[model samples]
Target: MTTITTRTVEYPADGLTMIGHLALPAGVDRRPAVLLGPEGMGLSDVERRRADALAELGYIALAFDLHGGRYLGDPEEMLARCLPLLADPDRMRGIGHAALDVLRTEPRTDPDRIAAVGYGTGGAVGLELGRGGVSLRAIGTVNATTTGRPGEAAHIRCPVWAGVGSEDPIMPPEQRNAFTAEMQAAGVDWRLTVYGGALHAFHHPPVGHPVVPGVGYHPRHAQRAWRDVVDLLAECLPVTEDLGA
Candidate 1:
């Protein structure tokens, strides 16, 4: 296994101090980068570990925070915070751009070759970043098929790949159709995958306590979705031999 280094970084966004985890692969002066976002519950070990895994693949990965450095275990609290934020595209862009700035400033990052990937709320933010005209090689989201404001998707210049559980009530059929329509109308390159027999947050592992109704983890689909995400990154942001031996 290749050695990787990671650290916690603090920055300001949305009237709070945002904490982000940055990971870098060993022996790489510069590499393609990815901005990782977490679910509405906020950044946890899951996202941090994902950043580390991306680093091992020779990409500079930075998992940015939501809700400061805190994780909301309460579903109501998570919604209360995420709903309004999601409603405001500018606010979502603020959070995303803040993280992007940190990632771009990292010495190991190849600023011109970067992508955004997120889950749930984080995924929404990644979409917002693309919609807001950020130059990204690609965008990938899991369990977040939320549609952006009218006509904003035309600003997205890269391909978008999204995956969601077919039974995810939060992102129902109508919502999925609307998202696809928006992407199509904008002439954006996009793909959507619906994993059958899965619920919301299928990518997550089993939590110690019960979660909201219609939210549970499906281990098999989870692994498949991850492979799909990695494939997207490989296609859009290929790692060269100089970065990965």
Candidate 2:
């Protein structure tokens, strides 16, 4: 049977309760852990499923909430809620650090082998964490757009893997190119994958929506992106004896 734990953690700074879904591999003393930042919609069932999926791969996954318990399927509403947080880099970094601390403090989590993964605006948050001098083993982002300010990438000390859809209108090709260039100039280890014909939120195949005209989900790319995420996590996280057996 799969072993998983779910709990809600409160942020003292904001007095907001953030739901956390934790999954641990059975019989492990300390396992590598991942800090999962939810998309603009906050901690939804989709994010919970992703955490469960990660547990199946022998890693302790912690999915965090950015907007408390509020979630909306509308893109405009999500943007309105997340834009303010995104505008203030310091506040965004604080949230990431807070979540990281919670994940690292878990009894079953290995502090040294911690990584972060995020989607959409949460991806930008994860990137900022790396740029804010967070000692992460690796970072993965899906359909992220906002690159950091000048010299921001210089502080990142870990490898970053960004997955984007070529056909995504929200994140244009020029922006992605510029972001990659900044990463290269900053001497940060990074990888970018552009999936042709894929749309925004490609990894969220279960969330059916027609947010943008002529843009929908792509199952093939979604599956591929998920596999890529698992592979990246396995590469960055330390191997445990339980998983080795």
Most accurate candidate by lDDT = 1
Off-target runs (Cα >4 Å) in candidate 1 are none
Tell me the tens digit of each residue's lDDT in model 2 across 81-165: 7888788778778878878878888888888888999998778889999889988999999988567878989998888999999
The global Cα lDDT (0 to 1) of model 2 is 0.80
Against the unseen true structure, what C-alpha lDDT does each candidate score?
Answer: 0.94, 0.80
Separate clash counts for every candidate = 0, 0
Give the range of the ten consecutive residues with the poorest summed lDDT in model 1.
236-245
Clashes of 2: 0
RMSD of each: 1.1, 2.1
- What TM-score against the true fold does each predicted structure earn? 0.98, 0.91
Maximum-TM-score candidate: 1
TM-score of 2: 0.91
The digit string of per-residue lDDT tens for model 1 on 93-121 reads 99999999999999878899999999999
